[model samples]
Target: MNDDPRRIHCDRHGAQRPAFVCGHLVSGVGLGFVEPEGPQDEDASDEQAAWCDRCETARLAGGGWTAQSEAAAGITLVCAVCFEASRARNTHWMEGVARGWRHTDAR
Candidate 1:
């Protein structure tokens, strides 16, 4: 009865024999097991950016990338990889909004 949250022990037939903790299946084979990695540091520069819901990598808005809409309703800043992935996942949309810009209408 292991108490670890990341570790998983399965049976010989890959039937998910049920262990002490929840597990994420790695390969389709039943001869191996895997432990999930820890969360990334939120303050890290690489971590600061979100994985483009479309490309699955960090989005660089100025680096030949564009903003796209997500099926979840709202915009998801994404890269080329994620853009394609998001399209495949059917979880994203395309729309534009102002970011980091100030409006003089308030004055």
Candidate 2:
């Protein structure tokens, strides 16, 4: 109900901030959109990736880190930790919005 940008939730918890892992599976995942360039202008782009605060820690834990599976939706950056936990309690991650995001610029 609140407007906390990072306030993502699990189907079971109602409202929760689950730990996540952002994978750079594809080179640039967060780019929003791109603009064409003129004869003398360079292309312009915008980033829409959700950068996580815990990514720094996960980045430091580099050894155990691995790329997520390639799901039908798109690249899965979030790890199964929270996903599995929610499943254990009979719920899904992102409250059934587990479908991954498609960065427009990735096209």
Candidate 3:
């Protein structure tokens, strides 16, 4: 198995399967390590920022950046890319507290 913790989970999919790990391990699939923001650890979240080939490509297509929520993880590690994608999109798995795209009931 790959020893790289970064290579374990797909940013798009959560703990599941159907994920791909590049042999060379030389791709921009990873958005980078998510360092918690705020004054203390209580306000921290999203520890990992890795993505799969498909999701990574999509993210790049979506301007190469997304947003994050407050309930990510202190060390959100990806275990596998299951058939089902993450509850939230990869674009929402950003580091600091998400700024744009607020959930509203206006149409």
Per TM-score, the best of the predicted structures is 2
After the best TM-score superposition of candidate 1, give how far the Cα of residue 43 lies from its true spot, in angstroms: 33
Q: Against the true structure, what is each candidate's TM-score?
A: 0.17, 0.23, 0.22
Summarize candidate 2's per-residue lDDT along 1-107 as a digit string, tens digits. Answer: 64765555445455544442233322333321111234422442221222222343443356422452212114232323444432334322343355563336765
lDDT of every model, 2 decimals: 0.28, 0.34, 0.35
Which run of 10 residues does model 1 get worst, by summed lDDT? 20-29
Tens-digit per-residue lDDT, 17-45, candidate 3: 33322221222333332222345445433
Question: What's the best-to-worst order under TM-score?
Answer: 2, 3, 1
- Local lDDT at 30 for model 1: 26
- The number of the candidate with the highest lDDT is 3
Residue pairs that clash (backbone atoms under 3 angstroms), model 2: 30-48, 30-49
Off by over 4 Å in 3: 1-46, 65-107
Better of 1 and 2 by TM-score: 2
Off by over 4 Å in 2: 21-107
